[model samples]
Structures are given as structure tokens and as C-alpha cells.
Target: MARSKKYFNPFKPSAGAEPPRIIGRDQVVLDFVGALEGGVGAPARLMRVTGPRGSGKTVLLTDLGSRAQDIGWNVVNITAGINMLDDLIHELSPDSSVDSLSVAGNAAIASGEAVMKVKHPNLRALMKRCCGKSKGLVITIDEVQDAPIEAMQLIAGSVQHLIREKKDISLVFAGLPMGVMDLINGKALTFLRRAQSEELDFISLIEVRLSFRDGFAVSGLILRDEQLEMMARATAGYAYLIQLIGYYVWRFADLHRARSMEVSDEDVRLGIENAMTRFHEVVHEPAISRVTKGAMEYLVAMAQEGERASTADVAKRMGREPKATSSFRRSLIQREVIQSPVRGYVEFSVPFLREYVLENADELLDRY
Candidate 1:
């Protein structure tokens, strides 16, 4: 028999990069495919795949799209967050009735409108007819939450019309938590309710309070249970943090030709330190406006303390009463620098933000 090759991975998730095949999300993929196959009731399904940043949303969507193609369904992917539908429509098929189904059906749909108009009519009609057939069509929207309200409304309207017409079409939207919230609040709610909303919950690592364990485990990067736990604790289950640690450990192991099966505590420590250096570079490199910087610093402080800070507390920390702090806080929240968990509790949601802040608290405070 041929010798078994050693496949060691450091960075657990290859989001932008394509994987040979999906591993862990088998059930999720099956559920999505089943919906596409009309395995339940309607072949048309809308699912919002959500998780924290770097939680493998893009990878999952890409894999699902590939799977959809393998089964003969035409797949149309639009990065709604980046471009509006008008831009997308113009890019896909120019010089055609925007709603003619045949304009979107040509084999070279990715190209000109002549073949598309003859084959597929409009985007909505083409997608509906394609989805109705044995070869279903799927549309996936990446970073869907950041999509403008107008785009969201337009997509929702299309989906609603399609469903009402009982056409065969399905959609998968992936984005940060905000994207899900936006859909629920907007006119999309009518469509969203009929669709399954799956929150890609983070891998729970209680000891490290993070999901690194699953990250390494799924990547086939074996580590001693204790060592893995330590690493998990340090990173607190953050997707990027886990990948950062894994990247370092794999690099160090490969460089030193050390044991591959079990990563050591020392290895974990070194990896974290290296990640911290990279984090520090990014955090300190940009000197934004004073107000933005001050608000960020204050939020960082709250994260380090592991407690939510009220507007009043935030004001006090920055040596400004509620008024100035309130204005700055609103901007920060809008920028996703801080989030309100409930009514009064404002907290930082980014992973390892506390540790980064504690390390540079003195310097950050000085700036303010």
C-alpha cells in the first residue's frame, strides 16, 4: 500500500480559499440541499446562515453553491453587500427587459443578453422556472446584512412574488448578525418567516471560552486535550483567534520538525504571543480622529473589565459627561465598535479585544 501522507493544517478555516470538500457542516449542507431538492415541501427555501466574523460563512456558501451546480442547478451568486441589484443586473444582462425570464436563461447567462433573453427571460422568472425543474437554481448572497435597505426590499419583493407564483427558487444569505436582524426588521420579514433562520452558533469552549477546539479538531490538526484546552482558553473560541493560533503552531512545528500529533503548551503560548504582535500592529497603526479613538478606547476598557458600561460610565471614563460621550457612542455603535446587549449595557463583541486593550490601555488613555 502507498504511504499515508501527512496533512497538517495550522489555520483551521480557509474561507477565501476553496477547500477540497466540506467536512463538519454535513447536516447543514444536507438540510440546504434537501430544501433545494424539495425534500421537505417547497424546493424553494430561504436560509440565513449567520455567525460571528470569520465563522466560515463564505466557505459554507461556496461549498453549497458548488454542490448545487454538481446536481445540475444553475447557481447565481450576488454579493449584495458590495453591489446593488442594478449594478448586478447590468453586469449580468445588459440591453434586455429587466424582468424577461429568458434573458437570464442562456447557457452563457454570465455573458450576453441575446442567448439569455432567448433562453431565460428575467432574473426572477428564469430563476423560478429553473428552480421548478429537476435542475433547481440557487441564489446565494454573501455579506447580505450589509446590503442597503433598497436592495433588501427588492430581493424580498422578488422572492415574495416568486413564492406567490409558486415558482421554484431558493436563496441562501450569509452575513454577520446585523444582516439577519436587518432582514427580520425590514419588509423581508414576510419572506423570512416562511424560511428557516439558522444561527451558526459558535463552538462552545468553556475553559478557554472559545471554539478553537473544534477548529483544530475539524482541520485534522491533532492536539493533546489539555494543550488544546489551554489554547482555547487563551483565544476564547474566536474564529480568527483560533485560526491565528493554528497558523503559528503549524508553522513552528514545520520549521522545527517537532512532534506533529500533540501541540505543547509552550507552542500555544508562542503562537498567542505572535498573534498578539500582529494584533498590536493593526490596532496601533491607524490614528483615527480623537472622538473615534476615544470611544474605541473606552469600549476596550469595558471589554477588559468583562462588564457592560453604561453611557454615564463611558462618559466618566473619558472625562466627559453623558452628552459628548453619547454622541461618540452612537457613532461607535453604528460602526460596530460597540453593541448594546440589552438597553443600558454596551459591550465590545470582538474577540480578544479586552486583552489587546489591557496591553495598550495606558497609551490609549493618554491619547484620549
Candidate 2:
């Protein structure tokens, strides 16, 4: 009997899962690392990462946190929620004694001959103790827009205090563009307006091709240049689709082969179809359901116009003045549903959204 061959799929399609290689984010990663090295008061120390769904904002945050840890900084990762502040406190100060530092009223507190009145312990002091020998503290919050305003305020206040004290600490927040904007616009988080904002865009085709080639080769499969190009084009620069396409294509190839081998065009086609189906079910449906009526109308008009549509064209199709459609256009852009590539042209930010809208337009328009 022949021995069975071992197979490993390197692509990860789950949310927040680190990819085998992070393509097209090298500059962002480098800037984050440089900020960590730059120490206290670096603008990049406070970062806000925004992108459309499946754009890998969480992955980028996770990778940056890992880089901080590797450089001797203490990292705490948490999702933005009602208990975000409490979670941060617990992560920074695990001991009960740290809680006692939050005494009421004006009480003189002495720490190594440095005396200060205690109103609350504050995150700064806790972080100071926690990062005794470490370079600093890095706190990453995902889905920041979902966090309660009170929690966001508390975090912002605490971070501001820490910054004023000149303690080494950094904060990174990842969320959708509008959500991030909402968080920043909060009354207490005015300081966040100054944060280094990084809006993640689509990955380049060249980079996607390189990722597929290198990723498959390491897994003991060879993808021909044309096959690689096909796969890359199918991904349409969306980070999640890249992994989804790769995962299915790799599996398709593996099932057809008894051992490691090359990926065929047939496998690529099936994989692309499967990936697109998943994309519609997972990304497109929910996004469409949440959009406003006006935004939906704009999207339908754009879908009818093909890949790239002008604002004037969309306005004409809607039978409304261009000025009348500006609000809807802005809303769509803020939602990351569409992007303006230039002054007058707008296109769906995600790949296949146009096709998705077109195929379902009859039903969608009926409901609308």
C-alpha cells in the first residue's frame, strides 16, 4: 500500500486570522513599528484604522500589537464593548491592590516619596506599574464604534492623562470608517481627532499575485503564472476574498490530486465561484440590508452603469439633481460601500458588489 501524503492549507478565511503573509500593508506596519520605537508622544502612537468589511483592519491591528510585544512592549487586545474600560483596567493591573488606588475624595497618596492627591487611581499609574521594565503599554481595541460612549470617554480621558504624564503608552483602534468617525466625534474623545488615521484600500493586483505564488509554493503546490493571475484577479483586492479564494482553490486542487501538485484552471474556476457565493452570502447581503433607501438607489444606479459610475450619471438615473444626491453619495462613502476614485467617478469599494446588486436588483427594487 502506498503511504498517504500530508496536506496543509495555509489560507485563513476567518475574521482577524493573521495571513501567512501580509501583502500591501508594509508601509502601515513599518510606520507602526517606527512609532513604537519613537516612544512617547509619537503621532502614530494613537492610530485609527478604518476600512470596509473584510478589509483586514483587525488583522493589521493584531500584527501591530505583535510587533509591539516583540519589542518589549506589553500588549492588551480587547474588543470595544460596554466593559472596555473595566477590561483595560483588569488587563493593566491584575492585582486587587491596584483597585485600592481609586480611593475617594482628596487623600494624599505617597509612592516612593512622590505624593499626589487621589481622586481615582487612573490608568496612567496602573500602566506605569505594569510596564515597570517594559518599554510601554499598547492597547488595541477592535470595533470601537460599538463601544459605549461612556466607555470610550473613560478610555480617552485615561489615555489623555497618561499622555500628559509623559508615560509610554499607545492605543490602536480598528473599525469601519463611519464608526471610527463617530467614535472620534464623541464629546470626550476630541483628542482622537488628532490620531493618525489609516484608511485601508484594496490590495494591488501585483501584490496579490505575489502572495498567491509564494503562499502556494510553500504549501508544496505550484501555481502557474496564468493560474496565479486568475486567482489574484478574482480576489479584486479584498483581503478576505484573497484568503477565501485561496482556501477553496487549494482544497479543490488537493482533492483532485493524490499528492502535492500544480493547481489547474478548472480548480481555480470552481474556487472562484465558491468564493463569490460566500462573498454574496457573507458580505453583500448584510451590507445591502443596512444601507439607507437613498444609498440603495444610488447603488442600483451605479450597478446599472457598470464598474465605474459618475455622480452625474447616478443623479441622472435617479432623476434627481446632482446636488440632491450629494448627501446619499457622502453616506455611501462614509459607509465604505462605495469609493470615489477621482473627483467625479464612484465605484463599489468591494469586489463583486456590482454583480451582486445587478443580479438581485429586481427583488431589491421591488422591496424598495
Candidate 3:
């Protein structure tokens, strides 16, 4: 038999990079594809996925677009921005380049220098023309929150008319929950509320475990049942953690290269510690920095309640009545910082956010 070759690190912990194995999102992809195959009138064609940062929204968007492409559909993938409409026009067909002419800025006269002039291609018309060349079309936009309301209006109106015409078009987008909610509630984009909405969150621990098994197997590391479970538990069912912790764990084993590629418990211990540090800097710090002082106070109060806490209890801890704190709760929920999993109870939405708060309480409180 041939020797087993050692594979390069299989985990992808970086933001927006597609992991070798996409766990727990199989159904979402299947649903998008099924809806696309169902043709124009399918309710799921216009879809939006929302989750907190590092929740795999970008990777899912790429996977969805790829699946559509596999079905012979033309895919136009873009990140929503002020120039989203122009970007779409160019992506759909670069040949539909903007008209250019030399113009004067100071006076209404021709200038010696040439200026780039956008013809402002009619996205609706351009989409229709492009559709004629393919079986169907999929436009996947990520970061919908960054998209201007005006740009959203043009795109939504075009898709609305196209759907009315029964064109085989699919519009799928992804963004953080806060931004995605704002977009859907926008007057021009309200119709998206009727579109299929998938909340990308933590993958199941079981799913993460199985993914770890397969991913680590390729790297020639031997992990026992409990060790694997430990790895999965460390991930806390968070999709991004699967990559982060796995990368560190695999890295530890690779560097040691002793004991015949067997990953010892110390490797896992060190891995978790290193991963937590990076996570604190990359994820937690930025997330906390964006919150208002009031929200920070609310978050710290919730953190004192441990992994899950009663909303009333949290309000009391903050020295406020439940009614007085309701606004903070609502805003936090909208911001994807805290989630009310059940009535009257709330918890931090991002994994380890509570710990991050508790550990850095002094610095955070002083800053806020």
C-alpha cells in the first residue's frame, strides 16, 4: 500500500474564506438550489441570510453562488456598497461599459483632460439581456448593510419587475443581522421580508465534531473520542470557532511532529488558549468597541448572569426596572449582541462574549 501523504492544514479560520468542509449549512444550500430549480415564481428565490460577524455569511454566499453556477446559471456575486448598482451593471456585462467624455468642472465647456463618465446602465434591462444567454441568473450580494438605500431601491425595483415578468432570476444576499434587518425594513426593500430568511448561527456541536473528524483525518492526526468531543465542545457550536480552534489544534500537532502525529491533551490545551487570545482581539474587541456606553453597561450586566440570564434579573442588576431596560434589550437584540432565546430571558449572541466581558471588565468599564 502507498504511504499516506500529510495534507497541508485543512482548517480555514480566516474571515470569508471557504472551509474545506461546510458543516451544518447543507440544508440552506439545498433550499436555495431547490428554489432556483423551481423557477421564477419560487418564494425562496429572493433570499437573505443574517448572522453575527464570523458566522459564515460570506462563505455561504459564495457556496450558494457556486451551486447556482453548477446548475448552469450565470452568477453575479458582489458586496453591497454605495456603488452596488454600478458594480452589478459592470458584473452582468463588462462590455456595457460606461460612456466616457472629457468635460469641464470649472466651466460648462470641454476640458483638455478626459473624464470617466458612467452611462448609468439600466440594471433591469441589462439583467434581462444577460438572462437571455443563460438558463437562469443568480445575483448574490454580501454586506447588504453597507449598501445605500438609493442603490437598494434601484436593485429591488429591478428584481421586482423581473419577478413580475416571470424571469428565471434568483437574488440572494447575506449580511450581519443588524444591517440585514435594516435593509429588509427599508421602504424600498420591504418586499424582501417575504423572501426566505435564514439566520446563520452556531452549527450543531455534533456536526462540528464530525467535521473535525474528517478534517483532521486528512492531516494524519489521531484524536480519541473524548479528545474529539473536547475539541467540539471548545468550539461551542459556533461556525467560526470550528475553523479557529481547529487551526490552532492542527498547528500545535504539526509543529511538534513527535509521538507519531498523535495530538496530546497539552496540544489541545495550548490551542484553545491561543485561539481565545486571537478571538478576543479580532472578534470581541471590535464588537465591544462599536457598542454605546449604555449598551456596554447592559452587556456587562448580562455577563454577570453567566451563560444565560433572566432579562428582569439583568435589569435589576443594572439598577433599573425591567421596563426601564427594555429599550436596551431591544437595541441589543437588533444589534445582534444579545439574543432572547426564550421569553423573559436573554444571552450573549456571540460565543465567549460573556467571558470576554468578565475577563476585561476593568478596561471595558473604564473605556465605556
Candidate 4:
């Protein structure tokens, strides 16, 4: 007899990859749809989504874009970078007109006639023409923090201009908290300051449990309530981690079945351990690497404390003045690496980060 193939992994571990079902964020999705239906000048049309690395900001943007497309609206999705503005203009430009432009150079258009000149098409004019055909245009920019200020300003200016002209246009930006704050504080993009901001927070444990249960049922697996809760708690409501846990646990159960053995708590425990390792390697390590040396020192000191660290205690541990420590604290909080639960106490925003830091303390502290 041939052995059955391993159970298919339904969960997606890739960044920005949409899952079979979005567990949380139902209200935000609804609000976005409402804004699209509301037409021009809706407050929800302009939004900034901020979150940590695994908080699903990109996925949320994709979800919103999909909804917009379903209603016959044009959606332009771009990642923020040096060429973001150019890409946006190209995407919005008339297909035939854009095709006439050379790959090595831009063509100038005057009196509806093309001339050989490297120039960007007027986004405002292109958008106006687009609005004539489609219901509206939704521009979704991911990784907003990485884009240059000039690029951001250009996109924001065009969106603001179109909005004032009563054109059906919407803009959604997704980035880290610090980047979002910088964009808001830019004098040229003051309009974005008034835009709706959605900070992606941890999903509720109850919802996490329910999603797992439903996902397992669809995969022909039976997960007891206790097992579902255990999986949810292990993920701590982090979106990416939730998928990781489910993927590994499903594989574990499949392996047990292949061996003619019942899936037990041991399989769950092993799966949780595997998921934790991947989270540290994929999310925690990369996130910490980008932080400033002083900020990392502060984080290392917090890890040493093994729990929430107070401003006074961390300052003392770092042997730095409280004022100096405060600066690092604010930066980390803005990055969503840590959060202040109370007046002066700070802890890692994601569960198990402290343990990850402790395990890799030497490697992490070496940079500082």
C-alpha cells in the first residue's frame, strides 16, 4: 500500500502573503469598504497602517486593495523606495501613451502629441483621465518608511490635489511606527497628519483560538478545545506566529498519523518549540539588527532583567543618565520593539522576545 502524502500546509509563512482567511481586522476591512463606497473625500480614504514586523501590515494593505478591486475600482499597489513615485505615475498613466515611451528614456507629450524627451507624465492629469473611466483609484504603498521623503511628498501632494478636485482617489500607506510618525511630521505632508491611522495590535486570544479550530476542521483534523487554546497561547496573538504554529502542529499530527499513533500533547509541545525557533530567526533577529547600537544596548539590558524594566532600573544597568536612557526608550517604543505598559516600565511587545534576547545576548550585545 502507498503511504498518504503529508498534510498540506494551509498556513502561509511568507511576508505580505495573504492567508486563506484573515483572523482579525474585520472592522478595519469594513471601514475601508465603506470609504470606497462613500466616494470622494471620505476620511477613511486616506489611511496609515503602522505595526511591527509580523503584525500583518502588508497583508492588510493587500486585503484592502482586493476589496477595492472587487467594486470595479482601479488599484495601484507599490512598495516604497527610490522609484516609488515614478512607478506610481507609470501605473496611473494611459496604457497606450505609456507604451509609446521608450525604455531608455521618457517621451514628452504636448497638445496630445508625443515628443522625444525624458519626462514624467503629469500624474494629476493621468489620474483625472483614469477617474473618468474607473470608479476611482486606490494607491497602496507598502514599506512607507523606506521611501525617500521627496517620493512620499510627491505621492501625498498628488493625492491631496486630486481629492480637492473631487476626483475619486484614495491613498493607503503601511509602514513601521517611526516611519509613519516621520511622514506625519513632515511639513509638506501635513495633510497626512489628519489621515486615519490604524496601528495593528495583537489579535485577541479568543479569535486566534477560533481561527485555529476552524482551520483545522477544514483540514480534516480534530483539535480539542484545550489543544486549540494551547496553540493560540503559544503564538501570543502575533499574526505570523499564529500561522507558524498551525503549520508546524499540523505537520506534527500528520507525522503521528503516518506512524499509526495518536497525536498527543508531546507533538504540540514540539511544534511550539519549532515555531519559536523560526520566530526568533525570522522576525526577532532581523528586527533587532536594524536598531541603533545604544537602543540595542538598552534592549540587552532589559533582557537581562527577565521581565518589565523600569526607566530607573534600565538607566542604572546601562550606566547612563536617565535622560539619555529615555531617548533610547522612546526610539524602541516607536519602533514597536518594546512598549511601556505603565508609567515607567517597559517590556518586549512580542512574547518570547525577551527569552530570545537572553539566549543570544552575547551576539546581540556585541554590536553595542
The C-alpha local distance difference test score for the whole of candidate 1 amounts to: 0.60
TM-score of each: 0.73, 0.84, 0.87, 0.86
Candidates 2 and 3 compared: the better one by lDDT is 2
lDDT of 2 by residue, 1-368 (tens): 98876768889888799987788899889888999898688889999999889999999998999999999999999998866666777787665333222222211111111222334566656767666658988889999878876566556666776777788888899998888897788654677888898999999999999988888888678899999989998898989999999989988988867654878888899999998898888888877777778888889999999899989999999999999999999988877788898999899877788999999887777776
User: Compared with the true structure, what per-residue lDDT tens digits does model 3 show for residues 1-368?
Assistant: 98745568889888888887788898898889899888778877999898888888998998888888898999999998766766787899887775532222211111122123557545777888777788878899999989876666656666777788888888888888878888778754566777788998688888888988888887778777888899999988887788899999889988767456788899888888888888888888877677777788889999998889998899899999899888888888877778888999999888899999998777887885
Q: Which candidate leads the pack in lDDT?
A: 2
The deviation in Å at residue 233 for candidate 1 is 2.4
| lDDT of every predicted structure (CA atoms) | 0.60, 0.82, 0.81, 0.80
| Highest-TM-score candidate | 3
Ranking by TM-score: 3, 4, 2, 1
Q: Native-vs-model 4 lDDT? A: 0.80
Error of 4 at 300 (Å): 2.2
- Residue-level lDDT of model 4, residues 1-368, one tens digit each, is 98765566678878888888897899888889999899787789999998878899999999999999999999999999876756777788734243222221111111121232235456566767777778888989999988876566656766777787899998899998877898778646677887898889899999999898877777677787888889999888999999889888877877757544444687789888898889988988776768888898899899887688888888899998889888889988877789898997999876688988888878886766
